[model samples]
Target chain A: MAYSPAVQELMEALRCLPGVGPKSAQRMTFSLLQHDRSAAGRLARALQTAADSVGECRLCRNLTEADLCPLCASGRRDPGLLCVVENPSDVQALEDATDYGGLYFVLKGRLSPLDGIGPGELGLESLEARLAAGEVGEIILAVSPTVEGEATAQYIAGMAADAGVDIARIAHGVPLGGDLDYVDAGTLSHAFAGRARYR
Target chain B: MAYSPAVQELMEALRCLPGVGPKSAQRMTFSLLQHDRSAAGRLARALQTAADSVGECRLCRNLTEADLCPLCASGRRDPGLLCVVENPSDVQALEDATDYGGLYFVLKGRLSPLDGIGPGELGLESLEARLAAGEVGEIILAVSPTVEGEATAQYIAGMAADAGVDIARIAHGVPLGGDLDYVDAGTLSHAFAGRARYR
Candidate 1:
């Protein structure tokens, strides 16, 4: 409360960040004001530019400043193998960890009708149109294993079937190096039920 | 690496935050772009305004957009008792934790010759002038317990002595409610040495 008007306002504005609370906000405010004003200026310009310019990519609905996202416009990635993810962060996560050279369709959110998030919110109409175009050979569902995600996957699978295209969901099981004893019952059961024959 | 130019630039700029890394930068970028463009814009404006306008307060060298920081400008605080701290964040921390109604002198940093920081960088010259003004009754050292902090406190103590002003340092001991068994030996020794007689 001893902070000046500008310092306090900056702290309040910083709380808009997802994980930044009041303490972190204050720390960030001081760190920027005291140590790195140039960095703060650069961040301000970047935020303004990105917020003003970035919009949904036309082809994949991923966030991009241009009409098409890099993966969608690259032409090097496999267009026939389309990966469906719940958010833009998910696309980044998968891209960082995997070599799946496939284009992505960002759903933005899963189907949660109770909360009024339905297929329309997930951009399923656009997905359906893409599926019906007969260009995609396979649809890969990389959605979370939540109830709404299950329903969304099922709905998308139905769309894929209607379009006479194959669909597959990413495997839900124990992680590669996870200890079985430490694994939760839900994950263990999922891993057990989806167990594969040993090669 | 699939990030577009604007998004990538935003992420890189975000890395300037003290504790944020690549993953957090990406996460923050997506959260801002996807969920809160208005918040992003607000943050951008705040950063720009704060970076451009905020400067060191004249009296105590604390950060403020005005000529003096709130604490320094407020006539209600005890100007006769000045507390010296390392940074603006320390001021906030002390304000949050304690009811010390004294004004503060922000050192910005301690004596670190290797880092090229010295008495001049910490505004010790202004502190000496303030002490020589003969209004202050006590000078409280609230700097850190690090080596440079000790040296800074010693140096300030010398200044207070030269000005014939009484100086005291905040006690360094184990925190209240801290378990003795878990407390580090150095802290325990300091606590033991600084022990007070119970009434």
Candidate 2:
């Protein structure tokens, strides 16, 4: 006979995740059903609670349960130095890898005109308002090095310029501890173009 | 600032699944929160419904919402020919790959003395009662080829012998579509030992 209706529905529902395919969804469904029912219940409740409460932070547009995210609310972070990223996860990635104690603005997406993602969709007007407040002195464009990311960065840079704020893009070069032979040509060229003077 | 408590809780709860590490869990958590809250809610509901309703079939020990699994309840399946497997997933695997229209017994786990698993833990007594009821024919041992699985199979074989039931095992050989050059020595030897006659 076929799988139970609930089991089939669970498997189908699990496929909505970013990377989960049919096989993974099936495996996850079976594993959760077989092994920890309590954990499953906790996951269900967690999803419900998070979904019901978590919304875009009013200040930075990052996922948060409150109006302002912790970074946005904290007085410790540098309000004058704002780092703009394509998504909330990028903010987390930068935080983990760097000691930059600055505030952030999450775009939630790159500017992709072909895909209908544009300035208005990314809440750029809100970002402009934040900039016009005159608190942020330097805006760091921390979008990815991809074509779409570069275009999005350029668009944000233009906005920052109009708002009379200085803008800087994060350095593109050989990764820390990377071998020269393995470094890509584009990155090496960028590194050469932006080289700092040796003592 | 740190992640919201509910977000943190959701990420932690997601790590309960097999093979899911911290990075995958974090990615999943963010994706769910950002993209599809309704799908996430459906997943949570499915988990709750499946956990509350799904249980082992009384007859075959396979997962079911009712007393008897579909295989056990169906008149089409051969009741006289029973296939025993280490877990319910194995039953699904066999069903997908083979035309074995027979009933099944799910052990849920193999015999592992180091972990204190034994005959009673596998519900072998109930299986024995089913065997003693004079199942008309053959029993198939479809356990894995691991040491614990072999030991479990042997134990079941002894039980079947005592019950005067004929038994067979799924063959061990180089897998179909496998390159012989990459086939391990143990599997190659099994293939040689089980060589078939040509017409």
DockQ of each: 0.81, 0.65
In model 2, the runs with Cα more than 4 Å from the true position are none
Per-residue lDDT, model 2, residue A17, is: 72
Candidate 1 per-residue C-alpha lDDT over A85-119 given as tens digits, one digit per residue, 9 for 90 to 100: 99998988898899999899999999999999988
Give the alpha carbon lDDT tens digit for every residue of A86-188 in model 2: 8887888899989999899999999999999999889899999999999999999999999999999989999899999999999888889999899989999
lDDT of 2 at B7: 82
Which docking class does model 2 fall in? medium
Candidate 2, residue B74: the lDDT equals 81
Error of 1 at B54 (Å): 0.8
Pairs that collide in candidate 1 are: none
Q: For every candidate, what share of the true interface contacts is present?
A: 0.84, 0.60
Query: Under CAPRI classification, how is model 1 graded?
Result: high
Score candidate 1 by DockQ: 0.81
lDDT of 1 by residue, B1-199 (tens): 6889999999999999878999889889999999899999999999999999999999999999999999988899998999999999899889989999999999999999999998999999999999999989899999999899999999999999999989999999988889999999988998999999999
Residue-by-residue lDDT tens digits, candidate 2, B1-199: 4576778888898888666888898899889998888888888888788888989889888777887877888889888999999887788789998999989999999999889999998999998999999974889999998899999999999999999999999999989899999999998998999999988
